[model samples]
Target: MKILHRQRHDQSSSMIFRKDYTLLIIYLSLSLVSGEFMTAGVVAVGSAISAGLLAGFNVINCMINECCTDRWVSTNYTDLKLTLDAKLYGQHLVIEPVVKHLKAHGKDNPSKALALSFHGWTGTGKNYVSRIVAEKMFAKGMKSKFVHLISATKEFPHKEMVPFYKDKLRDFIEARVKECPRSFFIFDEMDKMPPGIIDTLKPYLDFYENLGGVDYRKATFFFLSNTAGNDIAERTITTWTNNLDRETIKLKEMEEVIRLPALNNKSGLWHSELILKNLITAYVPFLPLERRHVKQCIKDGLVHKGYYKSEDEISDAKVQEIADELQYYPEGVLIFSTTGCKRIHEKIDLIMEEI
Candidate 1:
């Protein structure tokens, strides 16, 4: 009689376990079908809890172990010390988002996952911003790897400078995950990376966690692309995502897009007189300053003064002397010089004589 009773008890326990497992499967199926992400999450957590209790493991201990695992990733914290007060980057006050995101990622993953997509025309500071962001990440104790594709010909090199096709980026990520397990990765020339690269990185977008069948990614990624002052088309990017079928289904429009404006010529009109002066004052006699150089100086001076301030402290006579001494500055110092430079000296000389 005792043996029979024990056999019955064991049978009942097995039945209960089977029932619970069936219920978990049903819940997951329903959650997935209904597209209720939160509900699915709850079901998963509950199932995990029930399973842990059945396995004779301390539920609270397991949770603590996971938390500790996350914490043990990085003991070093980054210091946000971006003192560059520019229009784009506010003081450290606005750095909370970046800091919080990075901190959370550092705790959970081996690396930071950041995607900085710079869209603009040629010479629009897209690459510049990427470099600056990478530097700032480094400043904050993050070892960042930069893949600059600021050009169409050169894309981000995979390991060994080998061929890295965009469609194969996810495969590449999977391949290199072990090598760069804990480094901030950036993709320059983002505009050229095949949509596949973006697709492979979608899973790393939100936060570090296992999504669907894949384990959670532990890295930060940045995408730098030139779009000539407009955001990359959502349909186009989305189309790429669909084509690549990243584990994380990212809508094309959902891409974190940052549009950088082209360098505004706040130097006003580059008339012959101003152009000549710019050339003479900037480089002449001493050295002839190109239009590009003068533009930068003017912009810097404005930034320094917190407004438009020119470094033309030299007297008009000196400017003229510089212009006279350096033929390179003859046609410079113009307010707007888009026209021809043929006989620019004659034109500048005439203008100077008249003035």
Candidate 2:
């Protein structure tokens, strides 16, 4: 039985070798007939073919799983702009800076790793924007191996584990950056993270070209927090009360309002070196969603779930019915959606079930 098994394995190996040899012959013949082998020389022709094959294999591998090849790392700035414009509602303040920063980062080698701090009320598109950015930057989106998403509450649940968590976090970041220089790290629930734990990221987020031989300058970091949600809401409400266009609210205005609160708040970034040293690239505030914006979200939800073919197919009455289901805030005015567009899909699912 052993002899017969060996004979079959040898036959299979011979078949594969013959197949590969035949393919090589056919490739060389095609190259010669096309005059490529004559002009480029035999060695150059062979190298070109080898590189093409390698690229093809890499493309296939990236489709099957996450990879660090150009296939996965390529960024689509146009698509990013279109997506944010369409899906993100009520945050005119978010669109320009996010796109411009990402475009600059994608186009040139940065002096330091790109770090963005997102602050806003829950469901105001903080997490949604993060996911969108990941999708636009990576072919596999958030599932890409280079994208590291760490939830503060889940990763560092206990204050006693801060020391151990710090070490583990440092080692993890170093390893990921070594594997892929363009690594993306996102920290969610930054408000719940224990103090001193996030300070460990100071080195990676700094202006240093390398830390211990690993180049972290090409990496990107995002810190999502609800620390300044109330402040952001109040500012937006004040703007609306003054009859000022929300779009006219500048980044500087929002930054001035939230910067102090963020530094003082008991979040991961609270008094952290990342804030004190000015390592954060931008403090993006996601403005609260108004009733009309919530209606847009409902229309989008209907279209996304296949309940409607297009936004036009959904009536204002239907959209308002779903929008009214969500709780609004600011007492008499009830100006902003308390939850923004968060869980809007679930709300749609519930309403559909009733039908």
lDDT of all predictions: 0.36, 0.82
Q: By lDDT, who's the top model here? A: 2
Q: Model 1 clash tally?
A: 36
lDDT per residue for candidate 2 within 128-160, as digits (tens), equals 999999998888778777887888877888888
Model 1, residue 22: C-alpha shift (Å): 52
Please count the clashing residue pairs in each candidate, in the order shown.
36, 0
TM-score of candidate 1 on Cα atoms, chains taken together: 0.36
Candidate 2 shows a clash count of 0
